[model samples]
Target chain A: MNRKKENGLSSEKVFNFCNCAFLLVLVVIVAYPLYYVLIASISDPYEVYAGKTFILPSKVTFEGYARVFREESIARGYLNSIYYTVLGTLVSVALIITTAYSVSKKTLPFKKTIMVFYVITMYFGGGLIPTYLVVSRTGLLNSVWSLILPGGVAVYNVIVARTYFENSIPEELYEAAAIDGSSNLGTFFKIALPLAKPILAVMVIFTMVAYWNDWFTALIYMGEKSKYPLQLALRQILIQSQATATMMGNMDGGYAEANKITELIKFASIVVGAVPMLIAYPFVQRYFEKGFMAGAVKG
Target chain B: MKKGKQGNTNAAVPKESLWKQVVKHWEFYVLLLPGILVTIIYKYIPIYGIQIAFRDYNAVDGFFGSAWVGLKWFQRFFGNYNSVRMIRNTILLSLYSILWTFPIPIILALLINQIRQKRFQRVSQTILYAPHFISVMILCGMLRIFLSPYGGLINILGEALGFIREPVNLIDSASAFRTIYIASSIWQDAGWGTIIYISTLSSVDASLHEAAKVDGANAIQRIMHIDIPELIPVIVIQLIMSFGNLMNVGFEKAYLLQTSLNKETSEIIATYVYEQGMLKAMYSFSTAVSLFNTVVNIILLVAVNKICSKLSDVSFV
Candidate 1:
């Protein structure tokens, strides 16, 4: 019996060791690329290309970052992205919260119909062409409102919020409020909204990340370069390489030198574009997991 | 006499009329108004315009005035050589992605749940989920840099390890496109996907594990008997949800990753629609193609949901 127990303990130790080792490998696989990007961004482009900056950066310079800031279009795109993310998050959270609160009520008239109306869109959309036509015809083309309004209400978020309200908030609270002669709106504003802080944070962060990362809407609606968001601007620099030539036109460098600097600039811009989201990630991660728990519990 | 009878009933119980109930809940309706309006305008209006797919759409004639051409655009789309390729590519990519990525988070979650040290587990999770926050554009940008023929990271490493004598242009390789796409997708989402499973696992009774241990079940045996059974419902639900979105592959990443050389493998339905509809302005044809895609998705979703319900007694709809 003692020998059997010893064998079990040894097997358990082996299992734990293997599990930790596998997870350690996974962490490295997940993290190494971002680390490489950071080190590459700071290292000399020549050394980067020569594979000298793999483990550590060499000939570190701030020239790439300086040039990224100096680029007029990237600067404009950054401002535009910030504006859109803030405004868009506010609009989305407001719409989702209000709609979710009303729908969560058992007494709301035509609740099922209202829910079905929203849910049908999730299964079927009118394809891209029709949506584009509607946007263009509505005089929203080339306007910031086009980006903000067209896809503002995410039905999934509304459903999640609605589920939270249904499960987390007690019917007794509403009953008590009603006993005190609180109207539906008053109860919603006073009781529901105040109690919804956790879900509200989740919605805000989700919407903010979505808007900040969005490039497709702007690509479709806005034609002007000045109005481009950071993602779109990055697309031009990194993917299409259209802006790199123009960006290099002002700098006093030959063909080889300019090519090298352009590579560095691409790396630097990636770091810049990602830094904001990464900075917010820890806080966002905590709330997001909580939100997911809330969602998964009853979903 | 009828009025007197109604008044007597009303006095017995203060029953409000439907109209009265609606009026009493006017504030609720008011709260619902913006959402309703946004839905009608954004979602319903586009659905209304879907009729143009049936018509010979011309911007000058407007949606109503366009000539009806039943199945002509559908015929045109099917008649094109690229249609089969696009559909095949879309299905294959999605299937491959689901095959590879679906099982990973479950395994990760199971392993994570076994970690004795809470701090190590949390830190590992944080690092894993970090990639999810990176934008698709930046991801593609990094891919280009890492896969470039001239002194790319992969090439440099390949040479150092003596795996390849010459640098290969992986980003432009038709064969490598799907692999790269799926790999990047797994990297981005596998960690984030663990949240649901981990949350589910957290709710599992610790007493069950202790009981299994007392029964001389080893760690793996305990995990198999106690943990996996607990995770089955969540896993099945997640699987069903994924199957629901089986046809809706990530268009953004595909479009961003496509080069002229790799377009052979990368031209999926969503990107095809965007190109034909917006870029080429073959609006009617493209809309028909997209409508076909959506119909296939709905059918797939329903069919999978039915199968899952029958097999597992756990389904999502």
Candidate 2:
């Protein structure tokens, strides 16, 4: 019986080990290419192309960063993207927060009708061309507002915010504030907005990422690269990478030329581009990750 | 007679008094004004440009001055050579993707749940979530390199093992396109998807699992009985959401992934819209197509939302 018990215990242990091993392999498969790219960016380009660059950098270099910054458009693009994201996120959050707050109130007249109207647009868009014509016709063709104003309230975020407010904010607080002779605006500004920190964090993170990552508007509206976002700039880099790749093909003694251009450096572009958000990630990770947690689990 | 007098007074409340009620609730209107103004400027006014679909949409003439052309654009679009292929490819690709991409994370989540090692689980999750941050453009570029016909990592392994006679052009082949896409998608997303399932699984009753163990049900049986059933509502909601997005094949990834070879299989509505509506200058025709697409999506959305509600009694609505 003791010998039999030992055999059963060892089988369960093996089962446990097998499960862990399978997941660990999955994790590596997903992560290594990305981590490898980061290591490759600093490695010698020769090693990168030869498939010898893995795990660590053979020669550490910041040439990729230096080259990217040397491009005249990179700085302008960074600033443009920053301006767009910051200004756009602020306006979006303000509009969404206030509207969501007012609509969340049970006593607000025409609330249902307004929500229905907004949700209707969420399901249907006028497509690209009509929207473009409308933007240009309004004389916003070359303007920043062309990018910013077209998509004001991301309806999904609004719905999430509304749900958060409904679930989290006690209806009694609104009543108490009203009984204290607080005006609608006062009550909302003081009580509701204060109580909305978690969802607001989520909203800010989402809006920031959306505005930052958005190049569709930049591509469609901004004819000028100076007005382009970082994504547009990154796209320019990729285009240049393609052009250079072709140009190198035309040159015969391409080994040295290839060495000059590193796949690691190319990979590093992603890191450089995403570095800002990664820096900001931890700050909002507390709320941003958990922000959706409230709604997701509750639903 | 007393009831008749009360009814007369109730009927005496005039339309003018209803107007008075509107005035009494003037603050509500005021509260709604700013939001309405923004929506009008940003949302509804642009919607009015849907009239372009009914016109030639001359850039020189603009919307109001453009000559009305009836359903000429729509007729032309549906009558075109590429129309059938484009529509069929879009639906097929999305259908295939939905079948593959939607359920993967749930499976990963279930697998991750049975693992009792806290450190291993945490590390695996972090590794998996990393790919979510990689942009689609970069992901496509990575896919290109990894699937390159010559000296690509995948081919090198295949050759060393004598698995094939020649290096395969994975991305270029229509047959291989879906597999490459699905694999990359799973690699990028499976771990991220597990988060939801793991959360759901943790809430499973410990006592229930203990009872199942006592009943001599093995691991697979326990999972079948307890875990999968618990995930049905989530799966239903996810399905409805996925179906609602049936028409919207994202432009960036598909556009990047397209080559001369796989273009036959890969072209979807979003990329087609990008090319025709924005890239080329077929504004009116493309706008009509887009509007038609939008209508279909909205109808599908409502239908699925209703279906989910009826079947599972769980819905976004």
Candidate 3:
């Protein structure tokens, strides 16, 4: 009976089987690296060293997590990341939505000129030194404003939000609001803002991610180590792992303990850094898709 | 001059009445103030600073007071010792990325389009695209650990398989940097990049696939004859966009991954610019080097945008 079914399988069935198998393999390939890190973070550093933690995590331990939480810099980095991401995302979204809504209006003056002005920046930009010089000249260096203000308004986000407003919001609502003696500001605040929740969510997610992941800005602008964001702090820890090891030369178990802790910390820090984004992802994911579909492609 | 100047029925008829237009939509104009202020401060001021590339820019002398050196900085960049090496490394790495990274998304999208199970498809997508959100620091750290000579998963596996006598320090090797860089980028982005293509493929008419099926065309045959032809324009547009920004090798990842051993291969123009401009304070010369990179990028962008428009009516512009 099994032989008969196998023989009777259509090409489509075979294709589906292969397709599923391929995707499963892809899932493993894509996910395993991250999964490996998570498992190694929790596993005995020895099991990880022995490579026995591959198929399943062996000798589970919370020592890495404990160490990470106990680290003062990591805690400070978390606070800094949160502050920047929240403040930056809020400012960026407000600017983007207001600018985009304004540009999306058919009656808005010089709309085409404004669009051209924005789009030109996408193709051309001042190189690093010039931009850095400008930032320094403005006395923005070593300030939180340096991170939030320099990239305060992304033109691409503006364009995307504009497209969303132009395509999604109905003209009748605006006209009706106008007829009802609603001023432009009133219509925008009452009508446009409420209708723009999806794009708003998209902007929030994007801006938050950008601010959270940004180290280069803080790396360049910050003169003090205390101002470093989580990503930059993580970079210092990872890149300067040798320094940590060498410093702990006379500690208990000597260089070996230091090396093992460094490895554990590396794995743990990745988990710490990534967990917030991953946690926030699913909640905003639907809005993300909706926004992308609405703005990114007409198809 | 304004481009969106249109004759209105409300009595402000002339196209040149900027004051009238501004007064008429005063609220909207007011709303635009914050965004415009930011653009001026952050974007245009930087453009004004680009002139420093041509001058001996002294912080004390300021913009206008800076000594006019004309083409000296550009000349110095071209005549520098590592100029050829940096340019060559940048081009080679970009080409390698384009070769290895570009096609995976298209192929993945094709494979994804074949899946019949909706739940599985969604799960796969979530799992796959998750990597895109991983920060570069975390990614580099992960790569460092995974590829370590001692007790790294890759090395351990290799040893277990008897592929080598002992583990190798892959991350620190010059020969391995480009491959690791390209591969990691592909791993991060390929899944996310499929979103646009998959969206395109979904909009491919169902009737065409049905017709092919009715004609006894197999899965491969249908994909080849129908799906790929429909995908060509999008692929071309994407390729053009990638090539246009070819010179902009990202600084963060390369800088994070760079070791003393791998510096020979990993030192691209962006990283070099950062070192010279920020670290060494060779502001003028580094500005010139980066200005060259930007100009090349813009030229490529314009050229490709033109070609794409002419060929496929799908230009990024």
Candidate 4:
């Protein structure tokens, strides 16, 4: 028995060591691209292309960042993205919370029917063209409302929030409030909303990330280039290579020089576009994990 | 006696009419109105507009005034030369992605659970989850940069490691499109996907592990017996969900990653719809195509849910 126990202990040690090593490798695989982008953004563009700055940035420079800031459309896109993300998140969270709270109530008339109304949307939709046509016919085309209002209430988030309210907030608290002559709205505002901070944070983060990353909505709806969100703007630079030429047109350089600088600007733009969420991620990670657990457990 | 009588009267009273109940809880209804209106306008209205799939829709004639063409657009889509290719590409891409990406997070979650050090696990998980926040545009951007022929990372490394004599343009290659797409998806979401499984595994009872350990089961044996079984239900649900969404491969990444050269493999149904509808302005034809896609998606979802429930007695619907 002693020898078997010893063997088990050794095997466990080996397992733990192997697990840690593999996990470390995974962390590096996941993290290195972002790290490389950061370094490549600051490093000399030619050197980055040459792959010489793998470990540490060589010939560090801010020319790429300077060009990124100098570009007019990118600046505009940044402001537009911020506006959309904030407005969209607020609208989404409010709509989701209110609807979810209403649906969570046992006394709400046609509660099951209302829930089916939302849940049916999860399984089916009219697809993209019809949705686009609706947005256009509604005169939301090329408007900020087009971005904010149409995809405002994500039904999945609504269900998650409803589940949170149903499970986490005890029924007795609302009953006590009712006994105190608190109105339903009053109970929700004064009691449920206060208790729902964690889920609220989760919803806010989820919506914000979604809105921030969204480019397709802008791509389809916004006819004007000036109103394009940051992702769309980045797409022009990175994918289409349209804005890159315009941004580099005035530079006094040959094709090679322009190419290098273009590559650098692409790297810088990615960093600029992605940095906000990445920075906010650590703070929101705890709440997101909690939300994930809550959703998964009940799902 | 009075309280008992009051309670009995409340119980004896007929349930309030729907309208009266709604009026009594008017505030909840008021709160619900915005969502309902939004859903009706944005969701249902579009669904209502799906009749245009049967109509020869034009901006001037409008949805209703347009001429009805029964199965005309659908027939056209099926008759189109690229229809077979688009359908094949869509299915193959989704299938290959599911095959490659599905098992990764389960393995990741299992491995993550085995790590004894809490801090190490937390930090590593944070790192792993970070890529999910990167936008698809930026992801495609990175893919372009990393796969470029002119001193791209892959080529540079390949040449240095003596794997290739020349730089290869992966982003522009049709054959590499699916591989790149699947690989990048795994890179981006595999970590985030682990969240659900990790959370599920966290709830696994400690006593199960202890009992197995006491029974002289090694770590692998304990994991096989305890962890895998606990994960099976979640896994089945996830698999069903994945299969349900099999037709709905994301348009943004595929479209963004697509070059003229790679369109042969990258042109899935979603992108095809966008190209035909929004870009080309073939509204009726595109709507018909999209309607078909949605129908297939629903059928797949229902079929998968049914099959999984019947086979394993575990399902999501």
Candidate 5:
């Protein structure tokens, strides 16, 4: 019996060690590439190409950052992205919270029917062309509203928000507020909304990140260069780099200067595109975990 | 006669009560108006416009004014040369991604749960989940750079390790596109997917593990007996839910990843729809194709949901 116990203890210890080792490997695999991108963004473009900047910058330079900032389109794209993200998040979160709050209440008449209406869209939808036809027919083309309004409310997020409202907010609070002569809307505004900070943070971050990252809407709806979001602008830079590189191939070393600049800007643009989210990550990380769990588990 | 009068009165009371309920919740309903309006306009209006899939769909003709073509466009799409290839590509991509990407998260969640140190677990999680937040265009750009034939890290490392005699142009190759796409997808999504499972794991009774340990079960045995069983429901639900959109892969990523060389493997249904509908303006034909895809996806979802419900209690519906 003692021998068996000793064997079990040794086996568990080995398993524990192996588990840690495997996870550490996973962490390195996931993290090293991101680390490389950061280092590559600051390294010399030639050295980046020469594969000398893997572990650290071969030579430090701010050329990439400088060049990216100097691009007129990048600045325009930045402002456009900010405007879209801010406005879209507000619209999306407001609509989501209101709808979710209404449906989460068990006393709300036809709650199940209202929920069915929302849920059906999750399984089936109007396909791409038809949706585009609707967008164009409404004359939303080449406008900011096209980006914000077409997909303003995500059904899945609404469901998650509803779950958060149902599970997290105590029903007694609403009852107490009701007894205090608060109307349903007042209860929502005064009591429920105050308690829903975690979900609200999640929704805002999710919506903002989605809007900031979205280029497909801009690609389809906004034909003008001025209306292009940062992602699309970055796409343009990417395409431009590829075009210049291919065009430079025939010219040998003649286009090398331009090629180098585009190369460096490629890395710099990634860092630029990701900077806001990365800065916000530490602050919002806990809420992200909570929000995701709330959405996933309850949803 | 008395019973009939009571039944009528009972019906009358429910109607009155419902009206009163509506009156009481009028503010909530008012708040819901924007959401309702948006849903109707953006989701339902276009759903109504799906009839264009059966019409000629000319801009001058408008949606209803266009001549009804019945199943003509569907026939044309089915008879198209690349129809089979497109179907194959779409299904294979979805299947491959599910197979490769699904298990890693389950394993990651398990491993993360096993970590004794809270700080290390949290740090690992943050780092792991970081890539999911990177925008598609930037992620694709990183892919291109990292897979470049000349001086890419992969190529350099491959050469150094004698895995390759010469650097290979990994991005442009058609055969390599799926691997690159799937790998990047897992890299981006796997960590994020683990959160659900990790959350599920937290609900697992610690006492059950203690019982297993007392029964002389080792760590692996406890995981097999307790953790895996606990996770099965979540995993099955996830799998069933995902099947609802089986035909609908990540449109943005696939579109961004497409190149002239990799177009053969990369020309999926979503991108093809965009090409035909937006780029070439074959509205009816493209709509028909997209409609077919959606229908098939719905059927798959229902079938999977039914099957999962039958096999186990876990299901989406």
Candidate 6:
């Protein structure tokens, strides 16, 4: 039945079938965990722990959320993440765009030198302690900007921005501006910046996602709990579960039930914290392709 | 009079400087300065501390004051017991993940492109993409419960199929850790990874596909001729980038999977750095290990990028 006796256009029948089957399997493998988690999060912890709620919730409960929110640190963690993401992205994008524009100019003497400085830093970074000391000695320790400022201008972003500036901005516009006695600064502000909106939008979404997801910096630099970003808080919650479960199993007389409940809450905390990015992704995803392609296609 | 003019000229020169130009065009500077200052203070300055890698760095002495150790840390790391285990696990895990996990997305990208039915494609894409957002902690939890030897879904299914008399302890087995990690990585990243591939595929000339169809090309042949060749550039780029991060086996996922039973397979450069450097407070030693990893990655990247540019059209640099 599958063999071709005479002439044929294509094995499209088998191809489409195989393609559909492949896609279906991939979808199931990937989506099942997310679906399972969503179902599990809303289901009663008792039922979930007992492994009763697989496809659907037998007993619904919001108690996991109640327990998480009531814990206090989750709320503070959200605020901390927000402060870091917004402030950091703003600062980083601004630096990237300006430096990109300034260096993009033909008239900027020794622009290549500054450009090289930026590029070298991208590939070679000082080890952790030296950076930690720099942050500490500069008295940025435990400060909000400490996390935000330290990672502000990503060199890759600068290069991409420079690419966009070089490719997208027309030289004739600059020449016209110069004819009208516009300075290099004026041309960038009025002409180049406005023309680079598509690239800018892409950078904004990319930066926002990066900043939002970043918790490693805070874990390294920010020692205070109040300053913990959501990821760090989630990490702490996971660590707490590991400690509590192991300790309760090992030495502690009781608290077994409490610890198990706390472990469930650890999983629940991850679900709650991820919703913001999930909600935000669809809006920004369309731009990711366009932005990256435009920036990455070498001139 | 000449000296007075010379002094005026020196002062006049800086006023012609970029910073002065920025102030004169304060509006532009106002817009750009915040980002500039932040990058300089935060990103650029920390990178300047790369010098400390050459020093016998001490917290009290600081980078400048520290004595020049000069590759001493590197020697100690190479000479240390069990350094080979980390090097082995790091390369092996990345190798397995890269070898097995990479093809799924490329195949997926090809499959998605072939599906003429837009609704099916969109729905499937959404389903596949949804899992990428779930954090590793939750995903690992699900894996623990599902892959449990007793009463786990997989084992239950296995029992139904009569594959095993008893369920296997998947997590506890040293061999199983890499399988789980690579599988989960494919699950999480394959769909999202397709976005790049699909984007690259979109640029593939439709005329070529049509020409293949006219020439009586089978579906397999069409893909072989058109889709695979079109994707070659993107594939090469991804290969280079992936090879660049060979040393950085992600801390979170590996650490989560690690246990007394599975530590042999699970430990890699990043986890070792964290445990030895951050946890153990062997700052110099840890930094030395991490610096070694980074240097090696750079060398590999340069080598890989060079080879890729020679072999194919795609090169990251």
Tell me the tens digit of each residue's lDDT in model 6 across B1-317: 43344345345443355555445445444544565566566556666665666787777787678888888877887897768988899889988888987888888888898898898987887667756765665566567756767455567657668997788888778898999998888877788888888878888898988888767787789889888987877787788778876766677788777777888888887788778766787667777888888888789878887887787643323
lDDT of 6 at B155: 72
- Positional deviation of residue B152's Cα in model 5 after best superposition, in angstroms: 2.6
Query: Candidate 2: DockQ?
Result: 0.44
lDDT (10s digit) by residue, model 1, range A1-299: 99999999999999999999999999999999999989999999999988898899999998888888878888899999999899888888999999999988776667888999999988888878888888888899888889977884789999999989999999889989988999888899899999999999999999999999999999999998889999999998899866454466566768778778888888999999999998899877889899987765463
lDDT of 5 by residue, B1-317 (tens): 43344355345544445678689789989988898888888889889889999999888988889999899999998899998888888998998988899899999898888887788888888888888888888888888878888667789778878999999998888898899999999998899889888988988889988888889988777778788888887888888877767899888878877888887888898889999998999999999999998988888998997888798843333
Model 5: what TM-score?
0.93
- Candidate 1 stretches with Cα past 4 Å from truth are A249-253, A297-299, B1-15, B314-317
Q: What is the DockQ of each candidate?
A: 0.69, 0.44, 0.66, 0.74, 0.62, 0.36
Q: Which stretches of candidate 2 lie over 4 Å from their true place?
A: A1-12, A59-61, A239-265, A278-283, A297-299, B1-32, B148-174, B213-218, B306-310, B313-317
| Candidate number with the higher TM-score (3 or 6) | 3
State the weakest 10-residue window (summed lDDT) of model 1 chain A.
A241-250
Per-model CA lDDT versus the true structure: 0.89, 0.73, 0.84, 0.89, 0.84, 0.73
Clashes within 3 Å, all models in order = 0, 2, 0, 0, 0, 1
First chain of candidate 3, TM-score: 0.92
True contacts kept of each: 0.78, 0.38, 0.71, 0.82, 0.73, 0.44
Q: Model 5, which residues run further than 4 Å from truth?
A: A1-7, A239-253, A296-299, B1-15, B313-317
What's the candidate order when arranged by decreasing lDDT? 4, 1, 5, 3, 2, 6
Candidate with better DockQ, 1 vs 6: 1
Tens digits of per-residue lDDT for model 6 on A1-299? 22452336345776788788877886776766666667766776566655676689758776566677766677888888888888877876777888777767554444567678677666666656656767888898899867766665677887888888888888788879978998867777788889999889988887887777766677778889888887777766664344223322333344555655564565577678778877777676667768878887562
Residue by residue across B84-145, what tens digits does model 1's lDDT show? 99999999999999999999999999999999989999999999898899999999999998
Task: Please write out the lDDT profile of model 3 over residues A1-299, one tens digit for every residue.
Answer: 66654543476788889889988998999999888888999998888898798878898888778777777678889999999888888888889988999998886777778778777777777778777888888999988889987874788899899999989999889979988999999999999999988888888888888889989989888878898889877887776673343323345786577788778878888899999987777677677777767786444
- Positional deviation of B245 in candidate 4, in angstroms? 0.8
Candidate 3 — which residues are off by over 4 angstroms? A1-9, A242-251, A297-299, B1-18, B313-317
Docking quality band of candidate 6, CAPRI definitions: acceptable
